[model samples]
Target: MPTERRIGPARERDRLADAREDERAHAVIRNVRAARMVAGRADSAEECSLLLEMLGLEPAAERR
Candidate 1:
């Protein structure tokens, strides 16, 4: 039981680290780091669009 409890927090910490790294990667590409943060949450292109619309923000300007 003790071992099981340790594993849960370890896994959660790892997941949070991965999420932070993902946003850091995005920060390098876009002005608003938050964009990368939100993009990480979206499961699909459609979902991303919906999120953007709701936030009243435009899609990333046509990637070169």
Candidate 2:
């Protein structure tokens, strides 16, 4: 005989919430890094612009 696994409503909600939180956290990190690059954290505006272009995002003429 095969056994069936079940998830209660509360547990299901918790799992969904955790997944969403993970996605949000990742987005926050990416946005912060992008902002830093745009603000000239590591390299010049031209270099960052080139990087952004390569990633298919618009190149900014100057740092943010």
Q: Which one is best on lDDT?
A: 1
lDDT of every predicted structure (CA atoms): 0.76, 0.73
Q: How accurate is candidate 2 locally (lDDT)?
A: 0.73
> Over the stretch 1-64, how does candidate 1's per-residue lDDT look in tens digits?
4555455888999999999999988865664555666788999989988887776666777778
* Residues 1-64 of candidate 2: C-alpha lDDT, one tens digit per residue: 7598789999999999999999999977786677566657537767776767665556434558
Q: Which stretches of candidate 2 lie over 4 Å from their true place?
A: 41-64
True-vs-predicted CA distance for residue 47, candidate 1, Å: 0.3
Error of 2 at 50 (Å): 17
Winning candidate number (TM-score): 2
Among all windows of ten consecutive residues in candidate 1, which has the lowest summed lDDT? 27-36
